[model samples]
Target: MENKQINIGIIGCGRIAQTRHIPEYASNKNANILGYFDFNKQRAEEIAKKYGGKVYESVEAMLADNDIDAVSVCVTNSAHASISIQALNAGKNVLCEKPMATSLEDSEAMVWAAKKNHKLLMIDQNQRFAKTHIRAKELLEKNTIGKALTFKSTFGHGGPETWSVDGGPNTWFFDKNKSKYGAIFDLGVHKIDLVQYLLNSAVNNVSARLTTLDKKDSTGKLIGVDDNAISIYELDNGVIGTVTSSWTYYGEEDNSTIVYGSEGIMKIYDDPTYSIVVIKKNGEKILYDIDQIQTNDNQTKSGVMDEFIDSLIEKRVPKSDAESVINSMRAVFASIESNETGKRVSISGTK
Candidate 1:
């Protein structure tokens, strides 16, 4: 018998869906967008009309659909747990956006729901799917950079107020309650998860300094959320890493990673279409242009969406499963704890 395409429901009709997730999933042959739901009914209707899908009046209605095999949650940070839990309890798989939840308790509940329902629960840590980061992971595994010694990775841009096409100062990103953290939560989660993925190692301890540098919101009013952050981490392998994330950087796109090891050095950057440059101890340098390496432009596709589709069709597990993302969340929570206590917090010994 031929396999039927898996039907998916989108829980949020926000920027992420319109920009990345929606386009990627719509292009995949193995997946079909069954419907979409948003708190703003108009937005959901608009996306559904434009994309040729149905609109559900509520998440409950979407969850009750027998055709919907999975739900991609693009909701704000605060709603991740509740929406995901409902979807899972309704016997549907989940593809949730990053920073999993606002607090460890919420994140734990989401994971519990997935496990209880025996459905796939994936976190959209798309940075792991980036061509640059993938190449770096391969090089690390190959020891092309030797035994990893220390690492530094960063992702930053001007505040999100100007990032969206609408240019509203009222983005969910500016809401500390909705976003959970600041730039660190919005952008830092990607790099932090990437560090864990590339090294395949756990972070043991972290000391963080979080600050709200640009106190003004999009409307130029004082905002309480942090705008800049610096965090130092000790990896389980004894390698140390320092991550600096900010929404106030005025220069170029600051997403890069530097890896130093006993045998060589490796660097990945995106100034151009993602590339990896490696320097060996023997004084030879190898440059990999990821765009050229990734035939069929696989690098440009939505890795999370593609993987989710593959997992559905192949009946296999995606590497970026809920448990793995939860580990990254542990680090994020640790940083917040450290920031509040003004001392280093150790994740290794925590529950």
Candidate 2:
């Protein structure tokens, strides 16, 4: 199996798959894209032309193909669980996009399906593979920052209206029924997951305020979803942090995270001038210049798919497995609950 190429069947041909997942997987020599599966045949065909694979008319067609070894489920948040469950039941390894499912129950089911079917289930929390993030985690283990004390992070952008495939308000990202939440769910999940990964802590409690303060459709009516949210979380390791996520930044994307520690401070993706910079308590500063994390807008190898394929070959769990990342998802949902109830909520049960 090491010498033989792994065939991949993709479940979505939209912006994410075409721009990031498909391209990254295509460039991997150990993998072969068997086909792309999308409800829209024309859209699938368009991607197939550029990515060198057939257009699958339906998901069943892709799953039935004996040549396909794994599937990448990149559909909307609502569809992630069902599609991934089907793929796992069909005996295919799954690489799902982040916020694995819209709810914790669905997330757990995806994990259970993978375990029950004996297939790999990895969530695409790609920030873990980001160069600076990995470096931060390594330094933290080495106690460079001397025990992360508190964190303040923000992830905001103009909006997803201009970020999706067609770039409009009608994208599933803005639909509450489809997406479940707005900025917090769409953009916040990544950062929340990053906090957990970098600091090696679990968010045990949350108090939040999620609102659709400024989002409206063409007719200027409330969208019934949160466009912005501010949350305070208590990690199991006694680290308290604030997370602000919004679709209303109205500027260049802001994906900044600052971790304050006993000895020094570590900032990731925050500085406009540098990728990473650390300032010690005694006024000594050190800057670690590094490349920005890859995204759909930026066409580069995200290193996620490459590592996922390597995990399959090595028969080991991927860096971002479903079971482990569920804690991050729990924190996200807990934030929503706290926002609704105006009280702190506890999220228990995490590995």
Candidate 3:
């Protein structure tokens, strides 16, 4: 298998599949897309025609194809677990999209299926692969900044309407049945996973406020899911931080994370001139002009696809595997519980 290219199948032909998964897999030398499936057959046909793959009549057909060594579960949030599980059970590795699943139980089930089938289950937590974030993690690991105390991480944009395949107010993102969550799951999950990865700590407590601020359906009614979320997290290591996910920022996107340590503060994607900045207690400042963080408008090769392919060929677990990302998914659910109960939720033993 090391010398053979992994045959890939995409389960959804939505915006994410077309823009990120398909192109990334096509660029990887160890992978080749073999099939495509979507609820909209025409959409699947179009993607297959453009990307050099066969269109499947149904997801079951795609999963049954013995030629496909793995499948990228790029469907809606609610279907992620079921489809991934099916692929795993069918003897194919799975690379699931973010938010893994709508619930912890479903996520665990996906992991269980992968383990039972002895297949790889990787999640697309792309933020951790960004050059800026990789550098920040290295700096933190090296103690470039002393003990990290508190931090703020934010991911905001106009809305998913500008990014989804449908490209309107009626995209599945606003529908709770399809998305299961809005800004929190769509955007917050990425930061939550990245924070945990960088700090080497799991979030143990969460308090949050989720609201529907501006987005509405074509009928002018408020969307069923939250448009904005502000969550405060306390990690197992006693580091505290705030995460804000919003789809209402009308200006330029604000995707930044800043950590304050005893010796200095580390800022990522915050400064206009630098990709990362560190300020010491003695007033010494350091600036790093690394590559810019990838955005929706300026898409870059998310190291995710390459890593997934390499992991399969090397017969090793990927960095963002399902088990590793489960805690981050737990934090997202915990934040929702805090919002509904109007109290801080503890995720210490929920794992």
Count of backbone clashes for each model? Answer: 0, 0, 0
TM-score each candidate: 0.93, 0.97, 0.98
| Native-to-model Cα distance after best TM-score fit, residue 124 in candidate 3, in Å | 0.1
Worst 10-residue lDDT window, candidate 2: 293-302
Better of 2 and 3 by TM-score: 3
Write one digit per residue (lDDT tens) for candidate 3, span 1-351: 789999999998998898899999998888999989999999999988898989998889988889999999999898999999989999999999998999999998999999999999999999989988999999998988899999999999999998888879899999999999999999999999989988989999999999998999999999999999999999989999999999999879989999999999999999887999999999999999988888889888888999999999999999899999999989999999999999999996633
Lowest lDDT 10-mer window, candidate 3? Answer: 342-351
On residues 184-248, what C-alpha lDDT tens digit does candidate 1 reach at each position? 88888888888988988888899998888774866788667788888998888888998888888
Candidate 2: what lDDT? 0.86
Runs with alpha carbons beyond 4 Å of true place in candidate 3: none
Every candidate's lDDT: 0.82, 0.86, 0.93
Candidate 1 or 3, higher lDDT? 3
Instruction: Report the backbone clash tally of model 3.
Output: 0
Candidate 1 vs. truth: CA RMSD? Answer: 3.0
In order of lDDT, best first, we have 3, 2, 1
Q: How close is candidate 3 to the true structure, as a TM-score?
A: 0.98
Measured on C-alpha atoms, candidate 1 has an lDDT of 0.82
